[model samples]
Target: MSWEEMLTTVQESLITYWDGLVGSLPKLGAALFLIFLTWGAVTLARAFIRKLGSKTRMRKNLTDVLSMLAGTGLWLMGTLIALAIVFPSITPGKALTTLGLGSVAIGFAFKDTFENFLAGILILLREPFAIGDHVECDDIEGQIEEITIRDTHVRQTDGQLVVVPNHLLFQNPVTVRTNRDLRRTTIICGVAYGENVDDARSVIEAAVREVDSVRNDVKDVQVFAQEFAASSINFEVTWWTGSQPLDIRTSRDQVVAAVKRALDDAGIEIPFPYRTLTFNEPIPVREQGAQDEAA
Candidate 1:
């Protein structure tokens, strides 16, 4: 091409591009202003939802999920409006269609996260185990410390904090130890075979009733003959006490101590293991004086 012709083409192109850019500046500025307004709106919407949640006595975690959802919906609407303004060719409908495909991809990528989120919402609504309720799921034993959208914080009996995914608790069997005011606990107490069965039962029942935490008023102490061991006869002593793990431990300790004392006073023997050894052939034994001389 000729140099003059190339220069003339470049000038026309620059002028056309400059005019287009100048024309787009207003739309860009308006879109930016709209985005700022959207941010303010989102903040206000979340605050309003939280306040309403508080008034309605909703749980903290549930309120958090609701506020997050409200904010997300508002932000999406604002973003769609801004996109429409910035690029008039892309309508909200087209934007939503594109987002739908993108959302499917996102859901697949974060499958577990979404599953846990839904499980958390259901758990909060159902109110199965509240905070401070001691529960055992699978092998985990703990108190419900906190519940979030993704996981639940469990304070174990040993004072360890475990963050467990909500799906596991929702899917697995959960034993709520503190579901009721009192729980029944049993222990195997044994006495010598020579001891009278009726006397031992009476002694164990009396000892369990004497425990400070035992609920003797609500339920009578129970003592049943369980089995005969190598050295002693076992009695299953049962009583009701507080439902917490600590409460159970404390009551068990008190009951054990009280039973031991009662058994000692009644001259009842709590026998230990006994072993008998038999030799098929005789062996020669050295005298103690001969062994000492060799040492």
Candidate 2:
């Protein structure tokens, strides 16, 4: 109960704690060394996975996922081993139980993140699209720059980078524009109603096929009489071309120009909108110069 008795007890307790700490130094050192080795092993595992993935027909994103999982497994095992070495009382069972509970808590906290991750995994597995492929999903049209575990980086045609959650792409309808080497493009070219339908069709088809970008050889150019407009008869000119935005645009420009030139040479008029406005009252109109002079 006295101060001296309390002081002696505290000193003895400190001495025992110091001795225990000194005795456990070797264990701590061993655990640190094991952790260092584990880091090296994880690095090697990732390098090996990447090499194998490249050699095989696996997707790059799937390769990334596999490497990540391998690293995670290695780190988990190493951590358990290190903890057991540092503290002899701790067992693998206890460590795994604690990890499971922590993981549950983390999963609850990051529900959306896990959803995207799972969606990304499915996307990588399904191989619906690939990096550098042009895709459109829910108004986001772009080339797939990268596919990560939680988000996909889309570089839009306008050069804007959009980070979209993988879940949205997985859940929504995605249009892969570059799914094949060739894409079908249709343009309705209208000629004057007085023009010969058969002659106009032949002219348009020949012109479209002549275009540099049009893949008319692989797929025949089709010029069908789609409908009769108020001013002209519309022909739906369809053909195959390169499967890229720029390629499509270039083909369209060339096709339009070639068709116009051919139609002009063939004496076929590409009619403009013919509007006849009916009014209850007629108003006098004057030329611009006359109106200005009158004003």
Residue 97 C-alpha lDDT in model 2: 94
**Model 1, poorest ten-residue lDDT window?**
61-70
Quality of model 1 by C-alpha lDDT:
0.91
lDDT of 1 by residue, 160-277 (tens): 9999999999999999999999999989999988899999888888888888999999988889999988888999989999998888899999999999999999999998887878
Candidate 1 wrongly placed segments (more than 4 Å): 1-37, 85-89, 274-295
Error of 1 at 164 (Å): 2.8
Instruction: Report residue 68 deviation for candidate 2 (angstroms).
Output: 2.4
The CA lDDT at 220 in model 1 is 83
Error of 2 at 99 (Å): 2.0
> Residue 220 deviation, candidate 2, in Å?
0.8
